[model samples]
Target: MSFVDRLRELRLDAGVFRRATDRGANESAPSAFIRPRPIESRSSKEQSVGRRQSSNEFSGRRFFSSAAGSPVSRPAVSSPKKVYPTANNSSWTTEAKEPAGERQVIKVGTGVRPDDPPSSLCPKPRSPKLKVGITLMTRKPHRFDWWLRYHRNLGICHVFVHVEDTPELLPLLDSDEFAGFVTVTTGDDNSLDTHNPNSPDNYYTLMQRQEEQVRRSVVSARRMGIQWLFHIDDDELLHLTEPFSRLVRELGSDVTCITFVNIEATPKSLNAECVFEEIDTFSQHLMLAYRNGKSAGRVSVADWHGPHRFTGRYCVVPVERACILHFESCTYEQWRNKFIKHKEMGEAKKNDIPFPFYRDSVTLFQEDPSGGKNEQRWKAFYQERKIEHFEQLHEDEKIRIRLTSCPKQMIDGASGSFCKWRNA
Candidate 1:
């Protein structure tokens, strides 16, 4: 390239730059490039006008300034922030209503939480102040004292006994433990007829009447400051290492009902004089247990009442914190005799009891004085029957087996001599 040509190009570029700079410095544009005009010897009238316009614009617009008493302008109208609510919060569910055509304030925090079912649908959890009612139907008067002492040991304050319909047994009902007895008689809603169900009509009537009575019992318990009403029979007991109150506390509100280990009563020896102590509460209380060789079985001896057990159908609690002690073959000698006589009454005289069947069936009958042999026979028969019954039930449904011959569970456990799951 020639030097003359290069020189001409440079001059042209310089002229263009000078022209651009002149336009910016003219001070007639909407806004000037430089700020704070210098104090010249003489200022143009146009420059003064432009500077005044720029200052007015700056004052009218919004910009943060720390200067005191400065005319602060507000921001221009713009869209609000968008918020998306999540499932962990309730802000979106209970949103505030907004005016028509205006932007709604959709919160971006957690969303709506699900509502739990009503207490009526699901009963509240068990409480420690539960009032338990026990009803035992026994023909023998001597057996009451044993059960009374046993229940006392079990931490029960109230016990209701229902002795069989016998005039001789009425006198003992005056005792403190037996005083709470609800002696169901023919006059009391015709309890005897209810037990002797000939047809479905009879069964229904009996069931309805019994359930009504049970409801009354529950009401009474509630009035006595019992938050939970437990219904149990004579042979049934609640076995818990911790107090009933603790069980309720640990289970919390999730547990509506709890099931316990159903321990069946099986005879340890054939001796009719074999007195079952506290250790027998589980093993020697039921007929199946006697036949099953110190085995345990489930019985519906105890249940809870409140909102939990008040469905159209009985709802068994899902948790296993509580168990029902099912006294399967724990009937007294007189009761066993009475049962045998009643079942065979159709073939025999109404008043004339079947002495042979009664005598053979009841090992612990007052008159059966054969030391251990009679009891042994009863135990053998019971064990055979228990084995048969167990075979009928699924293996998973079988009761836990424990030998009563082992040192008494109560004494051993109390003395720290018992081991978990020990065979002996």
Candidate 2:
């Protein structure tokens, strides 16, 4: 007989089946109390046969009775190890026990298997939509409020400002007005020692400090998860033909940075108090190697020559759709202060360099027969020169000027004297 049949015969002989049936009918009686018939009542032959069969079943090879009533050996069954997904759902790991009692680990994530690739577990990275930041190095706290609002409105994610000799603005930096959006870094008093005679005429030390400031801003922006950074001056504003985010996305992955051409914005009349109110027209001549800023993250800037140049391994966008509205000379007073600041910074002595605006301004001041204090003549000269510059523009330059326009709301409300200009 088969092994199952033999086991059934043994149970019947022991009266275990009869006892189990009786216990089931008497539901009140506990199953544990059921007893097998006394083995003494059975013959010795039957008892010896049962012991031999039980010993054979438990031996090294589990046995089963075949069709011919011969014992057959079968392999032992093994329990399967369970696998679980990780929190990110990217991979899975399972632990299995070995025969030697050591634990074996198995990785079975989406991409971990031989047939799977990294793309199976990890999705293709999408281009960042709105991770751009702006960094400005300025000492003019008066324009900070308006400048901050302008960039914030443009959907810039972060702004880093390096304040030079502007301690009073520190309170605004700490205020909740710009809680997480704006960060301010201050330059030491020694930064103003550009006029020291020991320093080179080109003020290499000052330029180095400015470069360091830009590096810090870039680092901070990267920490904040910013994907692109633009380094602009306080007096300049980036003019975008479309949404900045869309512009960045369309640039594609290959382009690491974009350099925008600069066009000087001249005021029609300096009668207005605010520069934004007075300046309505931009120059037609694009500054070829003038002040330029970049718009990409993770790029290493080895050297910062000026607002227009940097040394690094990055591809520049070929189109000139992005341009900087450079308010180089806003008002007579502002220009005078800027000229003096530039002179002290050793910019006036850099004749070998091609900074047209600086060179022209300094030359005008030096050649002035009235010892540079003739305000009316300075204004007239500036206006005449601006007209001449505008007339020299090519057709393409004219198109750039036509495409650029300042948003009135940028300098409106509490951030600026919008009403004051409106009432005037």
Candidate 3:
């Protein structure tokens, strides 16, 4: 990289934007619910940590260790305290409250260099970069590329991308941008109900694949020296108020699991083509599907409760408000494609499952699985829920839409990285 080339890549912009209305004044935060929960520092306590030692496995106060099938634990180091950050209570501006087309956050990184050496005034030695990684499942090139760059710029270190649906895209993972950091898997080792990428797989099979991947990725994360690992989807993004590495520095060694709250992102209009780029506004009033969100746990978790959780036992997960921005059904095409896949795969109707969309698809497709009639049914369902205007969200019959800016903060904060990649 020559001086001229490096200079060309440099940029200058506000780290974050504030609206003229400063909706934060009236709303306080995104919602009345955006208050940070008080977590007592474990540094004050002197309780003895119960180290659960297993054959070739480590647990309790350790980073990541699974039993039976896992590799030997790494040489123990005097690790820093474990503590997750308190959710942000920062003020926010909502789309409904602001003028049309007014954006809340538009941030960019200016390639700020590190401070020269720590002076006596700031005597504390800088801690190691908190190596945080994420487990994601991706297929579409456009979607995966954005996800990789966004999370990478936002502070995610290693990425475990399972290109389950499209093995053809596996070669792309070997590219320069993804080579060293990303670990690509194709569910090749594990014998599942299906192997053909084009073949239809039921919802159960997909869940099995996710759980299998979780099992394998934990061992890999541990080997790679990743202390904290989060499991999220391609359509979803983790919106942290602060850096994830810093979040780990705040948590006590006792806590093992973190439950990230999910807030659904509603498109600004009926057909908001691109969900990630176009859709920013979110409703926190608990609408559509379950609100279980996602989870991030230490690689040392013992058993698999589900993909969202690593341990069946008590792992000290906090009651978070909303940390994950879930972009589900933001576009008519998105909704149409999802149901079509579910229908074609012969997804069984699970009564216990609260995912109404999948269940509805099963019932509807029984009448007509394909053709123009099926398309009409999906269109009707989408129209009933789509937010045509700000007023529609304000007066939603199912649930009131209280616009939030949690995701936009992270998105804009890494704007420079996104722009550079787009140009490159």
lDDT of 1: 0.35
lDDT of each: 0.35, 0.47, 0.50
- Model 1 / residue 33 / CA error / Å: 80
Worst 10 residues of 2 by lDDT: 50-59
1 or 3, which is superior by TM-score? 3
lDDT by residue (24-120, candidate 3, tens digit) is 4433321111122322233421211111111111122212222221112233334322222221211221121121231111111222213323345
Worst 10 residues of 1 by lDDT: 290-299
* Residue 156 error, candidate 3, Å: 0.9
Q: Supply candidate 3's per-residue lDDT for 377.
A: 60
Error of 1 at 249 (Å): 1.2
Q: Distance (Å) between predicted and true CA of 348, model 1?
A: 20
Once superposed on the true structure, which residue ranges of model 3 sit more than 4 Å away at CA? 1-125, 139-142, 187-201, 269-273, 301-303, 312-322, 344-350, 371-377, 386-392, 395-424
TM-scores for candidates 1 onward, in order: 0.42, 0.53, 0.59
Greater lDDT among 2 and 3 belongs to 3
> For candidate 1, lDDT tens digit of each residue in 201-305?
331243444454455544454455445444444445444333445434333343343333344443333233423342332221212321101111111222323
